[model samples]
Every structure is written in structure tokens, then in C-alpha cells.
Target: MTPPAALTLEFVSKHNVEGDLWIIVDSSVYDISKFATIHPGGLSVLLNGDIAGQDATKAFYGLHRSEILRRPQYARLKIGELVGRDEQQQNVPPDAIGSTSSIPYAEPTWLAPGYRSPYYKDSHRQFQLAVRQFVEDVIFPDAQRHEEDGKPPSQHVFDEMGRLNIIAMRLGPGKHLQGRALMRGIVKPEEFDHFHELIIAQELGRIHARGYSDGLGGGTCIGLPPILNFGKPVLRDKIVPDVLAGKKFISLAVTEAFAGSDVAGLKCHAKRVKDGWVVTGTYARLPESPKDRSVYVPLFSVFAARTDAGGLVVLVIPRSDGVQTKLIKTSYSTAAGTAYVTFDEVHVPYENTLGSDNGGLQVILSNFNHERWGLTCGAVSAQRTILEECLKWATQREVFGKPLASQAVVRSKLAQMIARVETSQNWLESITFQMVHMNYKEQASKLAGQIAFLKMFTSRNAQDTARDAVQLFGGRGITRSGMGKFIEHYHRTLLIDAVGGGAEDVLGDLGVRQALRMMPKNVRL
Candidate 1:
């Protein structure tokens, strides 16, 4: 196809009318005569006499973001470059424009060639590329489809993940991943650290299908840790391989209708029987359940419940007779298999007890640091995506004959969103670095409060970013399709991150309390 010829300023000016509207933006001319009526800001803005025959550069910048010019629908309307401008400078190579986003802060600082980071290495970059390709090519489509269909990712997805050892890799650096090949062997096991885990969480979040991301292996991410770290050797040997191989599903079930972060307030009871234990009560927001149609056989759950001894206990219970699950739909997709699980006289073998009889509190608490950190990583990454979306929207979406990004108010909101996201990401990296060097016990002792606070902070930041993105997107933000689907989904579901990993209020107080204990005797108020 022949390229469109460039139009002179005189030629552009001649077509400036209601019937033949033409406008110049960034030295390019667009014929928006047909788009006037459909423009969200209304027709008068496009038909104004002053804008009709002249360059609408200033006006266009005020409403639309730069990305709008790249949209196929708008790009096709381009008649040509301005008559006097250098053609080479005016026309950007298609490949360069398509490869990476031009909007500032649209990607992480590390992804930009001019920026440097001490944290990421060649392995991290290679791993990132492989994971991104996998997500974009394989996981993203599945996530979107399953999210819309209100179902979980297919078994084939799990099998593929199992083949690549992604399930084991997500658990962070541990003995379980020691021998496993990860990210198609892009990074060696011995070299894997919290940074690599951070990469995985962030990349997975890019799928933008939160529920489906959880469904793919969300349950296992949290559930298998206790079993692998503290369960009896026989139990660990029996369950770990199958779960990691994607032949089984497991989840952590600690919250109930009456008690969420208040672990001590749990009402589910487990009584010791002659040969085993009988558990009875309900657990809410479980990520995996046998009742979910997509789950395979041998579904398992690790939950904390009250024992007859009046102390909290953790049990790894398998789905069997008398174990019932009822779906509890939330703002996010049901692909997560959020469930109200009831263990009615369900027999759990003594061997199934994950930690010591009444010592389950430590086991449960031990997982929180990792869990909250994971939430922080995902939330921060999601916020970045939201920021990028807003940047693209503001640049491409014109209002009053200018790009939305050109508006001062929109720029202010974008600045705030970017600041919050960057702050959270830096904090997350700092905390992750600590995890890499500190032993588990040291991490639990020294970093718990910090992780809690970080999670709380990021959740709040996500709320702010989501709000700004929705406002920038306008109607499309609320609508489920088109440019706003991600922002819409994020707005509706961001609360899960705020409340799930430990509610913001709960964690905020916990951080202060934990910090108080570490205060020095010599330090005065």
C-alpha cells in the first residue's frame, strides 16, 4: 500500500469545517469529520471555527494522551505531515514505536535502557523476558477467557506450569526449588533469590486477570509452604511432588465469617479422636476447593482452627466425606474458587497436623511475611500497569481538540499515582533484599513489621492509583470492555489486596506493636 502524501498547512486549513473537519497535532494532520459526533467531549469542541482551520496542538494535548495517535482508527485518518517539517524527524519508524512505550514511567526504570539498577542482573533480565513472553503468549489469553467465563484456568495450563516448574519457583527461594529447573532454566536454582520471586509475582500480575492468576496457582503459593517447611516428613514427601506437578490443588484456609486477621478468634474446632481428629466449622475465602469444577482430585487445604486444648492448631486436611464447600463470589472473578468451606466431622489423621498440636500459631504466622510481601509486589506492579494505562489514555484520548495529558489536572493525578507506585516498588525491593540475606527465623523476627507496613502502604497506593486511572479513563473506566477493562477490574478488586494479606488497619497496628517491642531500653520518648 502507498503511503499517504504529506499535506501542506494551506491544504489542511481549507478542510477545516463541520463537514470536512481536519486538525493538526504534533505536526500530523487528522481528518476527524466523521468522529465529531461520537467524540465524548461533544461535537462543538471539534467544530469550533478557530480549531477547524488551524493546528490544534495545544488543545489536543490538553485532552488526549500521546497514545491516541498510535491507535489504528486514529492513525488511519492521518493525511500526512505538515508541509515544512523534516519528513524524517516527523515520521517515527513503525518498529521503534511498536517495540516499547514512549510514555514516561510507563515501564519500570530497569526496563528502560538509559536507567541502571543494581538489583537486576543478566539472569533476571533473561528470566523476565521468558516469563513475559510466556504470559503474553500463553497465560494472558487463558486468564482473560477464564475470568470472563467465571471459571478457573484449564488443567493444561497447570500442566504447562508444572512442566516449567513455575509452581515451585513461586514459593520463593527454598529447598523445594533447589533441584527444580525454573523459567525454562533461564536462572539456575542456586542463583535464585527473592528478586527472582519478585520478578515472577510482578510479571504474573501483568496478566491483569487477578482471579485467574490466583486460580493458576494462587492457592498453592500460600498453602504448600507450611507443609513443605513444617509438616511431617512423610506428609511432605507425599504431597509436595503431586501438588507441584499440578496433579493436585491445595490452599490456605485461615479466615472465617467471624474472624479474618484475628487468628486467635477463629471458631473452627478440631477434636482429637482415637486414631485421628474430627474438624468442624467453616473457613471462608479458601482459594481452592474440591467442589470447584476445574479442580482435580486430591484437593487439600491447610487451615488454622481451635483445638479442644483451647489453642490454635494448623491441619493439612484433604477433601473427603463430610467436607463441604459453598462458593462465595467476590468482586473479582470466581476463577479464584473463593469458597466457604465446612469441615463437618471431617477426619484428619494425626499425621496431617502441620505443626505441633498447639504450636500452629507460629506456623501460620511464619507464612504471613512472604504472603504480605507477595501481595505488595503484585499490588505495586498492578499500580504501574494502571499508571501506564492512564498515560496512554491521556495521550491518545482527545478532549476539546487536545490530548487529555495536556491538562494540568490530569498531569497532577498522574504525578501522584506515579509517586505512590515508585515509592512502594522501592520499599518492596528493599524488603526483598533483606529476605535474600536473612534466614527464615531472622526474617520472621526482624522483617515482619516492615513487611506488614509495606503491604498496608502499597494497598493504599493501589486504591489511589486505581481511582486516578478510572477518572482519567472516564466512562471506559467503569465499563467492563475496551480501554477501561483493566482499570475497572482493578477498581472493583483492589480491596482484596488491602484486606486479604492482613487488613490495612490490622497490619498497621501490628507494625506499631511489633516495632514497640524492639524499642531500646535507653531510648526515651
Candidate 2:
């Protein structure tokens, strides 16, 4: 952790040969003689006379991100710094991991310097910084590792999250946060409004691993809320604490093979029993239905089934006898815990029923509103990240001896990316403000259509942004690693936002139907 030694440029330049190659990047001296051999770009690129120890700062940054230098193995290569200067790395703030980006339009307007907003107060701002730090220190490494290995997130990460009560916070403003200190008391539990929760969602999307973002606790966010609101006291009291503490996992099981958006069409059924209910159903095991089912074995499932009366009944079915699950390799990383689940005569206690016996539709519909809003926050965050990446790359990357930004078409693409993300962020924030003032029932009635439309708009914009990003990043955008890794991941995981919570087309229809329901009977334009 000590500051590196200081070295003169004269001395650094002397070691430019193959056996003693050196480079100066952002006033830091790195001896790459040994590292060059194993460098992903190969030794030839580093050996070029112009770059060999001759302040390769420009060249180094041209093809790579600042994070690559932050890796321990690479960071340790900094034996010293330039003799008479401060250490200033490109694109890295002094407290880079937690600090806000200085890039124009890189962050939400409220986060930009000198920009102010009525929606976010001091508590919200401090909470945003703290959450971003927590995500970088606690979540980023795990996301990067598990995203590639296709493994579920590490338990230690979840343990840390639990220690910080982050798992509970992800569920948003509620009674669950009453006693727990949030972000080291930056914000009080009662004062923690929807904006605070919005910050958490936005910070999480910065992880850039959609699957891990969900895998982190996606199930709990959508699934537990239903039980907490409607389940019997006994059931809620027992399941709420454990899942919030990260001791267990839960996923919404409302979707089925036959029913993607049409919940009424699910074939899953539950027969009345002596003590509880005997539930049986076969899921198409599609991506949306049972996501995260097999991530952590023995997780609780909140699903619906048709009753003897032909009405839908919602229940919490614990994974036990006759419950089976199979993993499905998805287009994105398996860290999402994508799987097909089957409930063959699974028993559900009567106490586990949520809401009225035949009112299952309302439970799932309510859960969808929150899920859609969260997804919109994340979708906007992802688009902003792509915009930042493209901006940096366009400025530094040379095309035909001039910066790529010089190209008219590239600038046009960048402009579109900017407009789309900003519109989404602005709309998302406006909706979030409404959520803050409205009660749950009010939100259910007034904001559901607005939220549905907002999510549809944000996600659809995300697709266009992703495409523009691919066009801007070019081959590197499609490449799975290095410079375009995030772009590739975002482009690949379109299903999570666009299709998971609710398909775009279906949500669009829902928004329209809700609007039609509210139309004035006798009003004229």
C-alpha cells in the first residue's frame, strides 16, 4: 500500500529494449519487460519503438479501460511514478471506485456537477454514493468472476450484503427497513423513499452483469414482496427475516409454458387437501418462469395454480418432495440461475396462501409494477454506461489518423445514445417522484400504467442504444472481453429487461388497456 518510488524520465526511457521494456502511463512507471510476454495483446505491440518506455499513456488507454490497470497483478507493476509529478490516471478519479464520473452525460442529471434536482435530497445523494461504493467493493468483483464461470454468486458476498442489510434495501421502502441502519446511517429507514431505492437499482446496474445483477437477489426483490404484503402472519414472519438476511432465496413462479403474459392460462393446479393444498404443475421451464429456481437449492417458490373452482390461488411452495428443477443454458450467463422447475404434487400449507383464496391475479399483478420500475432504473443505468464507454473510446481511438469522434456518423450515433438515455433517465426520475408521494394502493391504481409504459419505453430505448453501441464499438463491441466486454454483455442479455419481467409487446398492450380503462366516458377532445 506504500506509494511507489519516483523515477526520472531519462532513466525510464533507457530501459526501452526487449529485455528491459518500460512504459509511462499517467505519470506512473510500469516495467513491462516480463509482463509483455503474457499480455493479452501480445509482445509485438508493446515493442514498437514509439510506445516502448516512451510514455505509452495515450496508446495504453486507446485500447483498454482504466480498470485493467486496477487489477492487482497489473497494479503492482507500478514500481514507481514519474519523478516530479502527481499520480493522475486517465479517466480515474482520486477515489475512482466510488466517485462520480466527470464525463459529460455519463451520469444522471442529478449526479452531474452543479446540476440540481427537486427529487433527490441530501440524504438521497449521500445514500447514492454509499451504495455505489458498496456495489464496487462488494459486488463488482463477484459479478466479473461468476459472470464468466457461470456459477452463482459467492456466499461470502451475500454474507457481506446481509451484514450491511443491502438485501433488505433492494426490496425498497417498507417496514422491513424499520430497524436496520441503511448505508451506515446515511439515510434513515423511515426517510428511505423510492428515490433511495432508485439509487440502489441504478448503482446495481453499474455492475454491468445483468445475470449477476439478478442473481445477486433478483428473486427476492420480486418474490418476497408478494408474500410480505399478502401472506398469513405466520408465513410472512418466518420467510421475511431469513430471505432478507440472505440465508435463503426466493423466486416468482407465476409464468408457465403456456402462459408468458397470460397468467390466466397457466395449467398449474392445486387440489384441496386435508391440511393444506396439493399443488402440481409443469412449467415450460422457459427463461422467464423459473429464473433463479436452481441458483440456490431449496429456495421458496411463490407461484399460482388453478383451484377446484377454476379460480387462481397463490401459495408459497417450499422445494420438497416431488419438486424437480433442471438448468437451462441461456443466451446470457448462467449466473442468473436460469432453470426449468416442476411441481409434481408439491404440498403447500394453507397458512402459505397469499391474499384471498381466488385472488391470485392481483398478487402477481402488484408484484409486476415494482419489478417493472426497478428494471427501468437498471435499463437506464446500462444505457448510460454504454454511452460513457463509447464517448471515451470515440475520443481516444483514432480512425484514419484522426479521432473516431471526428467521423460524422460516429457523432450521430453518440448523439442518439445520449438522447435516448437522458430521456429514459428523466422519465424514470419523474415516475420515481410520483412513487414517493403515492401510497401503495394509489400506486397500484394510478402509477401501474405509467410504470408499465415507462419500462416499455426505457427497455426499447435500451435496445436501440445497445445497437448504436455495437455500431460505435464495432468489432470490439461484439468481442466478449477486454474493451467491449460490457457492450457485448449488454447486447447479449437483452432478455433480462425486455423479456423477463414482462415482454415489451405484452407490457405495451397492458399500458394501453390500463389507459383505456381510465378514459373519460363523456369527455371530448
What lDDT score belongs to each candidate, Candidate 1 first? Answer: 0.82, 0.83
Task: Output the lDDT of residue 486, model 2.
Answer: 89
Q: Which predicted model would earn the best TM-score?
A: 2
How close to the true structure is residue 430 of candidate 2, measured as C-alpha lDDT?
A: 90
Regions of candidate 2 where Cα sits further than 4 Å from its true position: 1-11, 83-95, 284-298
Query: Can you list the residue pairs that collide in candidate 2?
Result: none
Q: Model 1 over residues 1-525: C-alpha lDDT tens digits?
A: 232475778878887777678888768877888887788888888877768867887667555545578778888988777878765436443333113456687667887768898888999888887877776767877898988997878777778878999889899887888877897788899999999889889988877888877777778888999999889999998899988888788899888888878887899999988887889998774575233474332277898889899988899888787887777788888888888778888899999998888888888888888989987888888888888888877776888878788999999998999899888888888888888889988998899999999999999888888888889988889988766888999999889899887899999999999999999888967
Best by lDDT: 2
Lowest summed lDDT window (length 10), candidate 1: 91-100
Q: Give the Cα error of residue 275 in candidate 2, in Å.
A: 1.1
